[model samples]
Target: MSDKQESIKQAAIALFAKRGFDGTTVPLVAEEASVGAGTIYRYFENKEVLLNVIMQGEMLRLEQSFKENFPYDRSIREQFSHLFIGLIRFSQENFESIMLINSHTTSRHLSDQTKCDYTSLLTFLSTIVEAGREQEVIDRDLPIEAIVAITFGAVVELAKCFNGGELTLTEDLLETLDEKLWRAIST
Candidate 1:
């Protein structure tokens, strides 16, 4: 959490997002961060370690965003809307983080703990769907895993489109996307 470490993390996120995990190099990240290549080693044990650090940091940020904005007292529909809006907002503001996460999750170097952490977000979403099912608000015909996969997949794809410049992340667009996703899972 020192300035040097943070700089390396930020640079890594951008590079990892643009060039991918395997495509990016430690020296390139060090140069982008304006630090000696050795400085990176001071913070991270190796390239894989640095990548994991960035992934874990982004995942934590995502979880914090959801926890801060989740509407626990609202109707299921409203809660879903809030969650969708939060995701879009997070992706818009932290494009590199989202891309870094997407890249890291697929990397073979990721540790089992990191993989579990990655799925933790999906598990949280499954719980929400489960709650809706209990309330007869969400379709109970599909398994919880399938429901979560479909919902999270749609959001991730839309975010990817925005990141790739195929679409813009606008308030109007988010509202429309939220409604569409809600209808897909709603009973």
Candidate 2:
């Protein structure tokens, strides 16, 4: 990203954290970015497009973080720990971005362009399932598609509860849910 693009992202992150995806507008992002409206348009055709780019970057960052922490030499348990723990840590670090993702997912205004950018998350989770299957930690017959859906749905719903202060994001919670998640995929 150019310096300007980075600046825009930073501004958008703060704004989205504060006002939410639905409440925020392109004009607000342009002003916060310290760029003209035209500049924002030059990079993104509209608010939905800009929001999608932001979401894609956020998910990519999460995937990269998970990859970095999943040491190849780790035990299968350790590997699963790394995967789940990495996700929780990433969520804590990027709470705002996660909130924005949730907001956009529910937003009545979300465009098709914005929704398509979220596909990487499914792929990332599927890779984790595949790894577990290869390690025989997860069920051999557990289809990747089904496990991916289960993981995604569980994470999103649990995250909503956590974010709403209805539940904790503690390590204990992660460990318990990790077990549950594994059980769902295991034989």
Candidate 3:
């Protein structure tokens, strides 16, 4: 992508994260990106197109963060730790991206491909939960979807707290949160 396109993407993600899809407009994105409205149109056909592209890119980035240096040979508990830490790291580094993703994954403006991409990210986490359940490490009473939802809900709320200035996300705090989330889902 050119510098202009990247700037548009970054601006749109931040605006969408803060104001949401319906609240945001193409002209607004162009203003935030320091470009003309026509420039945004030159790159993205419409606001929906831009939103879908941003969602797909952000989802792919998140999935890659979990996959990077993932410990396949480790015990399920260790694997969970790795994934949890990966999420924390990604959220901290790309707060706007995470905010946009969490808020807009179910937007009516999302394309089918964007929905599929989001589902694939969930499937990756489900695979981990399924493995843990099979190994008798995670709670078997809960469905895979519930387990993933619980974990994500906890972490996402924690991220919100941190972003809202309600809590300081120190290393010690993160470790405690990770352990607490693990115990919540584990047997």
Strongest candidate by lDDT? 3
Q: After superposition, how far is residue 157 of candidate 1 from its true place, in Å?
A: 2.9
Clash pairs of candidate 3?
A: none
Tens-digit lDDT track for model 1 on 17-82? 889987899999999999999999998999989888778879989988987957898998998887
Model 1 ranges off by over 4 Å: 164-166
Query: Which prediction has more favorable lDDT, 1 or 3?
Result: 3
Give me the candidate number with maximum TM-score.
Answer: 3
- Against the true structure, what is each candidate's TM-score? 0.89, 0.68, 0.97
For each candidate, the alpha-carbon lDDT, in order, equals 0.85, 0.72, 0.91
Candidate 2, position 20, lDDT: 81
Residue-level lDDT of model 3, residues 68-186, one tens digit each, is 99999999998899889888878888888888998998899999999999999998899989999999999999999898888777768778888889998898988998898899999
Per-candidate total of colliding backbone pairs: 0, 0, 0
RMSD of each: 1.9, 4.2, 1.0
The CA root-mean-square deviation of candidate 3, after full C-alpha superposition on the true structure, stands at 1.0
lDDT-best of 1 and 2 = 1
Error of 3 at 63 (Å): 0.6
How do the candidates rank by TM-score, highest first? 3, 1, 2
Q: Which candidate model has the greater lDDT, 2 or 3?
A: 3
